[model samples]
Structure formats: structure tokens, C-alpha cells
Target: MPASSHRPSPASPLEDDNLLPQILLRLPPDPSSLPRASLACTRWRDHVANPGFRRRFRLHHRRNPPLLGFFDGCGSLDFHPTLEAPERFSLKRDEGDGVRRPLGCRHGLVLLLVPKPLQVIVWDPVTGDQHRLDVPQGLTMNECYESVINGAVLRAAAGDAEHFKVVMVAADGDGVENRRAVACVYSSETGAWGGFVTAPIPYDADAHASGLFWRFSTSIYIDHAMLAGDSLYWQLIGNFEGILQFDLERQSLSVMSVPVPIYSKGNCFKLMRAEGGGGIGFLLMSNSDYIAQLWRRKTDSDGVA
Candidate 1:
């Protein structure tokens, strides 16, 4: 055999055993790239698809995360979270023929409410897996315009498969100028829409009688809720004193007072998981300045923050 014939082909950095993790760590945060990268070769595919690799990839990105994407009422918006140039791509629909807009986005899943028949679709943009959920019975076709609907998507467990819960709050005006309203919830695991757990939203009685409540109701509808711990916190549009709280575990409803008053739009408040582990926390941003205040619910304190 000729000596030249015995020489090996050019070495690929990917072929280096010690450099495998380093190579994988540099991959884009988008899940769409996983399948294509796996197809590079059998060994590469297995390593890329490995459970541990996926977990580590998630952690790495969490620390130095890329811009996966974001959404608005119009449609899904994709932009790089970091300074890197944004990747160009279009979102694919697993089902439905007509146009559907995003109603809620969380836990990497976009909850889309389709018009015409009024259906709820939970889509995992990463896995391309989708679930067409049943709309709440209380949400009637005719009453749609008269009601306020708020929804949130929650992952049942972290780092798990398609297990999730979709909660919807349909509040209908009592015709008393928005001082009174009714609401309901729908759960995916139980496959049922729960009953109406109504509550009276705080209103300025003196101002309400003067028709101020009616005018305020036009702009100050209850919407944009946040999920933390076992409760969902909904901000009152015009009211800065309190927030509507729904306990998912108890299926009960109550009103919670804010630590400080806020008059700006509801975007100033947010609910997030506690970093120390367990419970939830509230992030209230100051309107006058760039400062943000965080209040955490104590695990043993029974809803006290």
C-alpha cells in the first residue's frame, strides 16, 4: 500500500472527543436547530438529543440566553435576545387553517385564541406540538364582545414533556358600570371549565354615581394577569390600591392590596417565581423613576408578602 493512502482525512473540531461539549455549547438557543444539527451524523444526533445535553444546554443559555422570541397581539415576533444578528424564520402552524392571534404567551408556549368558533390552541413553538383546547362554556358566541377575557399558560412541571395548564378568566359586566363582574377558569388536566367564581372589583362609589365609573370602565377593564405560586394576580386598570388574586389550587378568589399605590398602566407590575426556591414574588416598577421593588410571599405566611 502507498504511504500516502494511509494518511487520515482532515480532522474536524467536532470529531475531537474532548471538544464535544464545547462545540455543543456554542449552538443557537432556538430548538429548531436541534433536529438539523442532529442530522449531521448518527453520533452527533445522539449526543445532541441526549437528555443531559438538553438540560445543560438550557442551563447555559439561561445564564447567557439568546433571544428565543416574543409575541404581541398582532402575531408572533422573533428577534434575537442578545446583540447577535437576528435569525430569519417564520412560525409554523401545526393545525388550524385560519389566522389565529396570540392571547397569552408563557413557558415557551403561545396560547392562541382562534376566532369564528372560539377555540383555544396551546402551541409549543420549539417542539411544534400543539393542543386545541376547549373554550370555556361561559364564553358565549354572542356575549364575546361584552366580556373581558384573560388567559395564562403555565407549565405543570419544569423540564418535562407537554404537561401544562391553560387558565382563562372571562369577566362579564353586571351592567352597573363595571363595579360588579363575574369570572370563570378552564383547566386542561381535568378537561373542564370551572364555574364562575365572581368578585366585586373595587370602585369609587362617589365617582361611580357621578358616571365616572362608567367612563373609567371604558379604559379600565380587568386584564393582563400573572401567575405566581398557586395564585394568579390580575391588575386593575385604573385602580392602584389592589389586585384581583385567584388561587389555582383552592379554586378560590380574593382581593389583594398592593404594597404601594400605582396609577400607570398594568405593565408596571409582574409576578415571577422566587429565586430562593418555592413561593412566588411580585415586581412593581416605580413610575416616577427607573427603580423596581420586589415583594415575595412567605411560604408560611398565608398569602402575606
Candidate 2:
């Protein structure tokens, strides 16, 4: 048989440009996955480094991205790896003053709060990209209760890993009858902070009757924000003990009381997505009975839980 007539053995399936990406896309969505794959050869490196491939890789694993590690924001800002050796990644410890606190992490980004100058740092550990945004005038130290400020970071749009947005919320008051919740959002794409959204915190009659109103006035304890539907929820503790809601689509702020009353301190509660992904809710542990209760916001009703 002529040499030209005889067919050469089938080239490795991965040699095909189309097939190569499909195989790489199945790789675990680990911090070191792409980099390690790229070391294989120039061809593989080019495929892994392609912008299109990167986007697809993220989308393919969008539903369940691996928990690479967590930032230890207690006393110091450090990353503790959870993955095994060789695949594990490490981030440089925060060199600035220990005032930096990790407010929340979502969409592969970390939101940090720096209280001194009242700034928010949106960091992407994988990309080593950092964006420092000045706190909005209304949410700044001089304007609001600086110690109670918290925020969250998320992708600007679904399945979008490049652009992101930061939502910062704070409780502000004059120690009089003007207590309120204020929130402002910073968009990376726009490179600016949006106008402030304010919601009046209703007076707690019980707190006032117990003579605890004044002490808690102008002060609030806000937990990390949780995203659900088109809104972000934060568990509020203080005179106005409820969940503060920031509607991303409407750009409005509102508050909803918890199903059961909870005190300012000595209570354990968390804001989370309701079961079956219905809506936002909270899990509260009763101090007296030591029993946990799950409460879901009634999206069909008027914010009842």
C-alpha cells in the first residue's frame, strides 16, 4: 500500500483546538488549575489563557465553584488555604494597619472594610486585582455610624466574572428622632458611587419603654450582607432589630422585622437564602430553649416572615 494511501493513526483528540478547550473546561475550578495546565506546553497555555476559554470555564462551574480558602479577618487579614498542597494558593497578608476587616465574600471577590479613612476594598484574590473605593459621603465616618458599616461584593450581572459591584450600608442617626439606614453602591464599570438610598428606621416602642433606646440610638450591629433575588439583606441589631433590605433593581432601602423578637446582644442569627431558593430568610437560635428556628420571608405577602 502507498504511504499516502495509508491513513495516519488518529491524532490525539486533545490536539484539536475545539476538543482541547472542552477537556480543559472540565478541570476543577481551582485557583491553580489553569496555571498548572498552562505549564503543560505552549499550545495548552495559549488555549487556557484565551479570554473566551476563561469565560467559559467560569460559566461551566458557575453553579458550584470550589471553596478555595477563606480570609482570616480576625485581628489580621490572612488567607488560610483549604485545598491540598500543590493545588493550594496563598495570598499576601494585609500589610496595612490591622483595621482592615473582611466584610463579605461572593463571586470570587472579597469585600473589605477599612474604617480609618472609611474605604472599601474589592479584591480578587485569583487575579490580584484590587479596587479601593472611598465611602460615599452619606456613609462616611463623619456622616454615619462608622463602626456599623458593612458591605457585599458581587458580579455586576449574572455569569459575569469581570465586572463587579459593591454595596455598602450603614446606620446613621443624630441621637434624636432622625435614625435611618443608608446605603450606596459602587460600580466598577462606572468607576463611581451611586446616589445614596435612605430608609427611616422606625422607633422601637419597646426599646424606648425599657429605657434602652437612647443607649442604642445612633448605633447598630449589621452582619454581612446576603444576596437573594434582586436584593441584599443584612441582619440588624439595636433599637431597630430587623433585617435591612437593599433592592438592587429599584435602588431602594427597606426593613423587615424578624419573626421572633431578638435582643441587641447575646443572640445568634444569620441572614441566608431560604430553602429551595425561594427568597431571603434568617435562622435564629433561641437562647432559652436552645432550639433553632428557620424563618422565610413571605415573598407572596407583604414581607411577612
Candidate 3:
């Protein structure tokens, strides 16, 4: 203990450089894009790729928590790391009852659907960049059929941040609508919703009905480019039989089957975003309690599920 040195003046009581660690716990690592985020990369891969991030991202989204929008009705939007409780920033509705439709998360923007307007609204929630899109018009609505249909919006694939796709399934339409349930893919980059990819009916019934009661189940991000090898996966309600998968590379839809003994009856309980990134997951709803089941897209299933 030299008098001159004096142990660096007893560490100066507050000469703290360890503040970085404490701050880190409060500030999450930089998040990667939805697709490539799960895969390893040099872009803060270790931190942004945390499974915790994946889980939080999914839960917050699946359970957006209904918020009374600036309209007659209300629904909640995802809480982006940048904007927590985005429902607070939700823009007012112009005409619809604000039937909240959690389309999908793309480029930090939450895609929503106003059931009454039959329109799609792209919400920034953070910047509150609200854009409403009237569902094309002229093309007959799915309600024309007695079958059943669901509309979902999803961010395309990697490197296509500027684009988003809306997939609508009008299962078993009467007259010409049978098996004619076309998948309408809307590209924001293209600024239009075009093409009829034909959504194969996984269930003969309304798929969303649970025990005579109409239950609205959301499609959970099952797996990302990681599992699809290039496509994104989503788990829909109606007996967890299969997942509706969209191929970002080719822009197509196929079914991802469930493993044996799992028997996804089609009633997927809770939808969770995958921790591995890229996609989301599902929670099995049971009377006893909520149990979770997991799966990834198998390149071999080929829509059989």
C-alpha cells in the first residue's frame, strides 16, 4: 500500500463503470428483423436473438389486449419494444366499429382489420402512422357463402420489409365459392392486393367456432424462415390440425402438419410468438388449465397438416 498510490483513492466511491450491465437489463438488445432474427448473425446476434425476446414478442402480440380504439369498438395492438401499450396511441376510426383484427407484425407496424369496414389498416402505434384500406370493393365478400372464412395479415419475408400480405379464406362458398377460397395476398410495396392463391380449407366447418360459440382465434407465428427453410408459419384455431404457412421466397401457401399423439384437434388455445424468432407458437386451451404445445414447419409435410 504505497502512500502515493493509496489504492486509487479508495475506488472513489462512485467511479462506477458497471452501470452498463444494469442499463442492459433495463434496455433490451437490438432486435433483428422477424425472419433472420432467429438465425445466427453478426448483427448483435447473441443479444437480439434471445429466446426471451421471441417469447415476449409473441405473447404481447397474440394477447394485444383489447383496447377501445378511437371508434365504436376497440381492440389492442402489439406493444413494440419502442412503444409499450401501443393501444394508447391507436388512431381513431373513421367508419368501422373497430373490430380489432391482429393481422400481423411487419417492420414494426401492426396490420389490423376493421370488420365493419371490411378494410385493412396499417398502424405504426409508435408514430401512429395510421392508413386505412377499404377491402378492394367490387369483388364479392366471403359472407356471400355459408361456409366460413377468416382474414389475416402478415409481413412477407426477409428483405421484404416494405411489403405486407393479407390472406383471406372463404371456406366452402356456395355456387362458385367452394374450394374457391382464394388467398388474397396484398403487397404494400406494390400498394395493391392482387392474385387468388386459393386457400385450401383445413376444416369443413367455420374453423373458428368453439363448442357452438363463435371463438375468434388468431394465427400464431409457429416458426420462421428457420423452420420453413424459407417460409413463415401460423397456427390457427379450429382444432390445431394444421398451420397455414406462407412461403416468402415463392409467395405461396402450404400446410404444416402436427406430429403424432399431438392430434391438434384444430382448437389451438393460446398463440405465442416463437422464441427462436421468425415465427410464433400455440398454447393448448384446456378446462383444467392452459397447456402449451410446440411445433416447427417440416420441409417434408408439404401442407398435409
Candidate 4:
């Protein structure tokens, strides 16, 4: 046999152009996975950096993206990384002189409410892209109570990652008996704010009948927009404690009272998606009993479990 016949082949499956990408696609969907792999050699770096490979990597792990980190959204916009050491991703930014409160985070976008000028800042931490949108006329600070301004940010379409939309909800009241919940949406693709959708806040029947004007100071809690089905939910605080529902498809706003009365002090509750992708629900923790209860919204009726 010739000497050349005894030599090993130049290409293996791992080194093959066609098979290399398929192997790389199976890498764990961590923020630092690709970057760490790229440090191996020049070829691996080029393979991971390719636009097509990047897109495929995202889609391949779309179902369960890594929990990169979370924003505190308390007094400032701070991102606390969950990944350890080398894999940690930092998103620290100068909030400037104006106070910025996080409204909600969804679909890889963060919604922030700037109180001074009354605008929402749509921020993408990964790409460092920001889109500042002025508050809609109906939900502006002048039009609605500034303290109750809350909103949500989500992608325009499920598969469309580049563009997003913002839904801002605020409580409009006359400080007497006339109180309404107003919402307006902003679309990135259209670059315009949609018309206002208003829903009257149900008055306290007992107070109204007693000849005393129902004046409950209501405000939407910040940084907790829970999306279920085609709608978003937020917890309402103040004299009226309930869950505010915003239907994305119908562009309507409604309120649902909680299963039990939520006391103003030491009330710990969070809205969440029910198990098996059922519907919106909430986990309530009793301060005194030190026990947790999971309540699922009944699909058949307006009751809570």
C-alpha cells in the first residue's frame, strides 16, 4: 500500500464545515457560552460569531432561555447578575438627573418610566439600544395621576425580536367620584402612540350610596406586569386593592378583585402564570401564618382558587 493511504484523513466531523455548526448549536444557551467557546481558537470564534449561527442558536433554545439576571427597579435601575464570575453580565447605566422607574421587563426588553418629562424608555440591555417615547396624551402626567403610571413592554409579534410595543396604564380621577383607568400603546414599527382606551374604575357601591364620594387613592404597583394568555396583569394598591387586567388583543382595561382582602401592611403577593400554561394566577404569602398559598384564576368563572 502507498504511504499516503496509511495517513489519517484531513477532516473529522468536528472539523467539518457542515457538521461544526450543528455541534456548536447544541451549546448551553448561556450568555457567556459562545464567548467562552470562541476563546478556544479562531475557527470556533468565527463559527459562533456568524449571524446565521447566532440566530439559529437563539431559536434552538427559545423555549428555555437562561436566567441572565434581574433588575431591582426599586430606587434605581440596577441589574443583579445570577451567573457567577466569568459568565456574569452587567447592565449598569447612568440614570441621569431624572428619576427612572422600571415599569416591566418582557420579550428581552425593559420598560422604564421617566417621571420628569413623562416618557417611557424602551431599553434592550443586550444590544444597548434605547427608544425614548413620549407619554401618550391621555395617560400623561397632566391627564392622569402621576403616581399610578404603570406600563408593560413586549415584542410586537412572537417571532419578531427587533421591534417592540409599550402599553402604559394610568389612573385618571377628579379626586371626587369620577375615576377611570386609561391605557395607551406605543409601537416601535409604526413609531406612533395609539389612541387611548379607557375603562371606568368601579366605584365602591357602599360609599356611593351613603352620599359620601368614594375617594380611594389607587396606584398601580411598579415592576410587576404578569403576562398570561394575551393579557397583562398588575397589582393595584391604595384604598382599592385588586388586580388590573389589560387585554392586548382587545385593547381594553378591566379590574378583578382579589380572592381575599389584601391588607395594606405586609401584603406579599405575586401574579404568575399557572402551571401547565393554564392562565394567570397569584402566589400569596401570609405574614402571620408564614405559609404560602398558590391561587389560580378560574377559567370557567371569575373565581380564584
Give TM-scores for every candidate, taking all chains together and pairing residue i with residue i. Answer: 0.63, 0.85, 0.50, 0.80
Q: Is candidate 1 or candidate 4 better by lDDT?
A: 4
Model 3 residue 232 lDDT score? 49
Error of 1 at 193 (Å): 3.4
After superposition, which runs of candidate 1 have C-alpha atoms over 4 Å from their true positions? Answer: 1-33, 43-67, 76-89, 92-101, 139-142, 177-187, 206-223, 238-241, 257-261, 264-305
**Residue-level lDDT tens digits of model 2 in 1-305:** 76667677886755687788899999999878899999999989999989989999999999999988777655466677788843333444445534677888998998877766767778788878788787777574355435778888999998887899998888777664567888888888989988888888877767644233334664445467788899998877666667888999999998777756655334577878999866887787867668888887665456434
Give the Å error, residue 125, model 1: 1.2
**lDDT value, residue 9 of candidate 1:** 84
Quickly count the clashes in candidate 2. Answer: 0
Candidate topping TM-score? 2
Tens digits of per-residue lDDT for model 3 on 1-305?
Answer: 76674444544424432342233333322232443443544433444455654444434443232332332222744343333422345466675455565544544566566677576677755445676776654234334321133455555654343455655543333332133234556677777877666455343253333232213222223222223245445543333345666665676766544443222344344434555643545545444445555643223356532
For candidate 4, write residues 1-305 as lDDT tens digits.
76665667789755697888989999998777888899999988999988878878877886777777788755466678777853333444445527677777887788877776777778877656788887877574355444678888998986666678898887767663466777888888999989988776655554433221234656677646889999988887654667888999998889887766554345577888988767888888878778788988775455533
Candidate 3 lDDT trough over 10 residues, lowest sum: 217-226
Q: List candidate 4 segments past 4 Å from native.
A: 1-15, 41-43, 73-76, 86-97, 140-146, 207-215, 264-267, 289-293, 301-305
RMSD of 1: 7.3
Check candidate 1 and list the clashing pairs.
67-81
Model 2, 247: alpha-carbon shift in Å?
0.9
**lDDT for each of the candidates?**
0.60, 0.77, 0.46, 0.74
